[model samples]
Target: MSRSQRKQEDPDLGVLSSRTLFSLQRELFTKLGEQGHPDLRPRHGAVLAYLDVAGSRATDLATQSGQHKQVIGTLVDELVALGYVERQPDPADRRAKLIVPTEKGLDHMAKSDAILAEMEAEHAKAVGEEAYAEFKRVFRLVAARQAGS
Candidate 1:
């Protein structure tokens, strides 16, 4: 079958474009793995992306990432075992602990930032800067709308 025919068969990809989003995420994770964070998975990214520089409670991270507290707790445990995150007593609440990124987590985030920049450059080149910018603008708008909803 021709490429056009295949695309027509999956028109949702052209309109909704979730495939593109997932593909980009996979590419970024692949880049991260190649850069030395071999154990990191896309699931780990949910917690990492929402993590605050100061520190965040696992429950807060779960809410921010739209994940359950138990799932976040498990991921946080793995991250701690990997030396990417550490739990410390929360001064505000002695019964709770805050999840803080370790030096290793900071390093991974640094590499992720660089890789994302490179990916953006490549995407801009492939899709034209104007189109890429529009894509980002639309994504932000959609996200905002969803948040409002």
Candidate 2:
């Protein structure tokens, strides 16, 4: 059978997931740009999304983001050049470094959180809060199962 024909017969979970992620990223970065963070990109989320407010190790960010350590290091370098994050001595482990957010990074985080909250609220409103909650629960289950986690 042809690829398109097979696609029509099967569930499009992968395609749907990709489309949803891309849409969210597009909306998110557009708003971020308008809010004074034009330099931010979707790739930056690999670090920003997993980064803790206090600070995080590059290895931790890599693990949390499911990215290679080298990739995380490159992202960290870009973030450092952009003035969003800085490397500071880790107090817990003197030999390790912590990726801490700067004032600008904090502002970006706050704005991103607010934007995502608004987007989720709109989704919940459109599909009824309880239904959206259930969708999330089921989606999480499916995602975890698929990931074998």
Candidate 3:
């Protein structure tokens, strides 16, 4: 059976979550593109979403993003080539490298944060503020549980 048919037959939590995630990603990337970071793609979020302005090690990013170290390394390389990030010496561990955001990356991060806030506000408005807050709370709990699993 086709994917749509399967969804229609059983609209489970997994299906709903996947659909919501994809929709959110589409809206987010489209807005980001309009804001001048058109080069970013959904896959890039693996690194960008978990990245810290102060810089982080690839292993940290991998853990935060729930991706493999090798995958994180590849994403970091892409981000570096795109001028979003660079490798710098870790102050604490001179031999280890930190993934530091460049000026362009900082700008992108700021823009993304603003966009996400706007989106959240819109959602809250759509579903009553209290209801939205509760929804987010439940989502976080469920996500944490699933991560452990």
Candidate 4:
């Protein structure tokens, strides 16, 4: 579907707009910064979100984030330095290190989730219940396709 048509049909779907996504991301990062987490950029936040779902090796993160392995390695280093994550010896593969969120990371995620939940509530209020539900369903389907690619 055309981007404009989608936006008009459901304002919440406008979140797919790069400008809108960036703005929302910046707002969330600002909120994180205010919470005393200064270096939590969107990329770093994505890494945290991924790790939150399950601990994974660096290679796994690279694949899931669609980022180069080298780039994800650099980010992982930064996250380790910031104490938001730690590398643990992967039991399944001793040579590979699994990235896991620290306690502080989990706490930060809780706060971040609260902010995101508020944003979602605003989106639902704007788009109505039915459209909001469809938006989530379709968005997930699209995301799965993109991830597979």
TM-score of every candidate: 0.83, 0.93, 0.93, 0.81
Q: List, residue by residue over 1-149, the lDDT tens digit for candidate 1.
A: 98778777766534456677678789988988888888998889878988887789998998888899999999999999999999999999999999999998998888888988998999999999999999999988987788788
Cα displacement (Å) at residue 135, model 2: 0.8
The models' CA-based lDDT, in order, is 0.87, 0.95, 0.94, 0.81
Q: Candidate 1, after superposition: displacement of residue 60 in Å?
A: 2.0
Best prediction by lDDT: 2
Model 1 is weakest, by summed lDDT over 10 consecutive residues, at 10-19
RMSD (Cα, Å) for all candidates, in order, is 3.2, 1.7, 1.9, 4.2
> What digit string (tens of lDDT, one per residue) describes model 2 on residues 35-90?
99999999999999988999999999998888999999999999999999999999
| Number of backbone-clashing residue pairs for each candidate, in the order shown | 0, 0, 0, 0
The sequence of per-residue lDDT tens digits that candidate 4 reaches over residues 21-59 is 798899988988998787788988547766743478888
Kindly report the root-mean-square deviation of model 4 from the true structure over all alpha carbons: 4.2
- lDDT tens digits by residue: candidate 3, 19-138: 888998999999999999999999999999989999999999999998999999999999999999999999999999999999999999999999989999999999999999999999
lDDT of 1 at 62: 89
Candidate 1 accuracy as lDDT? 0.87
C-alpha positional error of residue 49 in candidate 3 after TM-score superposition, expressed in Å: 0.4
Worst 10 residues of 3 by lDDT: 3-12
Candidate that scores best on TM-score:
3
Q: Distance (Å) between predicted and true CA of 104, model 2?
A: 0.4
For candidate 1, the TM-score is: 0.83
